[model samples]
Target: MTVDPSLSEEIIARAQSYPGIRAGIARLKDVLKAPSYQVVPEGEWSTSLSVLQESTVPEWPPEARSVLVLGLHHPKNDPRLDWWDRGNTNGNRRLMEISESLKQWLRKELHLGAYPLPYHVEWGGLFLKDAAVLAGLGIIGKSNLLLHPEWGPQIRLRSILIEGDLQPNEPIEGFFPCETCDVLCHKVCPQNAFSSGAYRRPSCIAQIDSNVANKVPGGEIDENGNSILVIKYCRACELACPAGK
Candidate 1:
């Protein structure tokens, strides 16, 4: 069940070949024990969302040995990347399509078992930021978002579970993006989510709930020529960071 370094590199290269994508690998066990799991126990009722949904306790497959984490850059100029229609965002849908394509290639071309995970933890998905950190994709900044070296907080993540153990990427060394800065991200938070010196999920969720309540008319018109509604979630904290801009 072990994969050689060459094979691992190949998989990573394949993932990154997609537009605006960056990829890394991590041990499944390491990701399962990520710091987020310590703060919030699995199967608990999630309060971060406006909707009522219990967090799915991860019951990952026994054979899963490695995680292939994929990050998609969401630059500030393109606000549409994070726009929500129906139940998902355009960025998230693109990630899903990429993961599914990689999964099929893994099975058919490499004969490896790959499982593409969902975007929501309530829908049997892993904690993507945690996994991305463990995969050496980025570091969690003051914004409470995964900040890549080149993209800062303007990146979204998705992951695929691999049956074979792949070489794990190491976290960046001596790279602290938030130190000695004015922390403009915190100041820009409409909810002051970081006012307590740390990210408050409740405060953040309050803003998200408000966004859901005040959805705007989307560019696309419906059958009756009425514009469809879309939820544009708050990104003040994420966009204010000047680290990777």
Candidate 2:
């Protein structure tokens, strides 16, 4: 079914009226340019997009017609947010907070049903990059993260599918900024994660499998299969870009 134009306008108006919601969106934009976050669009990154659709919740609400995607900038300076620290929860806390706040505001102001999604692929949630693209946030970079025109690839994302036919936001069109720049992201990886050609889905799956199989409680793993808990940050590709910095 198509989104109801009037309903969408109403929702947009209401969303704009909420100071918290507006502030949160502003914070997201600010964080993207904070020298640490990146913005990748969704359409260009089909591999990640495919994975996300496959992971989305099997049964979405009948009324869930549009999605409101939110992003949190995770700059390299604050590397801890990307870490699977303690219970693998620290990195996701910001996402959780944004989702919760958005949901609360939507429910209170618009009387709409919203579902806060999870990050893991196994949990049936779509990729943040895909949602961001649909939400007109950014394009997906070769590095596999969402890249915004203003903020390269240093952002975290959260999304909620609304259970009402709302107007979908216009998407950013025909913007490819990474084409002329030298590929610096590939050069900066300490682990040379991008040394090979673009990531092959099968290869990545195999590597992740190997990682999970060898993972020991509270320890790290290197190529030799030793437990060290180093948790390498893979933002080399993101850091290599000169966009939002």
Number of the predicted model whose TM-score against the real structure is largest? 1
**In model 1, which residue pairs have backbone atoms overlapping below 3 Å?**
none
Give all TM-scores, in the order shown: 0.91, 0.65
Residue-level lDDT of model 1, residues 1-245, one tens digit each, is 45478988999999999999999999888877888778764232343433322233266787878889999999988889899876678898899889989999999999988888766776767789999998888899988899899999899998889886788888877768899679999999999888888898878888998898899987999899999999999999988898774
Report the Cα RMSD per candidate. 3.3, 9.4
**lDDT score at residue 89, model 1, on the 0-100 scale:** 81
Q: How do the residues 93-175 of candidate 2 rate in per-residue lDDT, one tens digit apiece?
A: 76666667768877888788877766653464555566677667777666656777655787776667677555566557887
Show model 2 residue runs off by greater than 4 Å.
1-58, 190-197, 201-232
Residue range with the least summed lDDT across 10 consecutive positions in model 1 = 48-57
Please give the TM-score that candidate 1 achieves against the real structure.
0.91
TM-score (C-alpha, index-matched) for candidate 2: 0.65
